[model samples]
Target: MAYAIIETGGKQLKVEPGRFYDVELLHEEEDAAISIDQVLLVSDGSTVTVGRPLVEGAVVEATVMQHRRDKKIIVYKMQPKKKTRKKQGHRQELTRLMINSISVGGKALATA
Candidate 1:
């Protein structure tokens, strides 16, 4: 099995080709291709490459699937005896991406 660890949207994600992942909102149109260069590590079952902060010449290709928001979360605050209550809800914007390939040194390692 081959996999790569990529950093995006201030978070690290373990990604594999052919899989879909939901990440923080990105400023790109749906169906657009994106290249992620902040690869921390890559493994191909037998060999592994690690980076100091980020790997050189390593990239992950992905396609923007969609843009959406997460489910609402409710926040409630109450002050007993004071008769004070506050309620709020929140939904986080997100984007869906489909992993297309993993490459290193301009050589493709895996493709979906």
Candidate 2:
């Protein structure tokens, strides 16, 4: 029941150990380790800690699984009487990560 809210790739996510998540693309080799310190909130079942902007000494560890692109989305536009039309498709780059652990003040709070 331990979890933390972290900021990355201009987004906030609720994460827990042993879970896989896809976020904005990361320029790292597969299997590379990374630690995120932009923790906004954390809960360890018994207590909760909230940060003003970011929690001090709070870190989340993860490993890069792979890099991929998300499903394509289409955009279409048309004009009446002008016969003008446009169509476009776009995909977002993403990175897959496996959360390994969550810690606070150098003490492990959750582990995969």
What lDDT does the true structure give each of the candidates? 0.96, 0.97
- Candidate 2 per-residue lDDT, tens place, 1-112, comes to 8999999999999999999999999899999999999999999989999999888999999999999999999999999999999999999999999999999999999999
Worst 10 residues of 1 by lDDT: 42-51
The local distance difference test score of model 1 is 0.96
Summed over model 1, clashes come to: 0
How far does residue 14 in candidate 2 sit from its true spot (Å)? 0.4
- Cα lDDT tens digits, model 1, 1-112, are 8899999999999999999999999999999999999999998779999999888999999999999999999999999999999999999999999999999999998999
Task: State each model's C-alpha RMSD to the native.
Answer: 0.8, 0.6
In model 1, residue pairs whose N, Cα or C atoms come closer than 3 Å (at least 3 residues apart or on different chains), thus clashing, are none
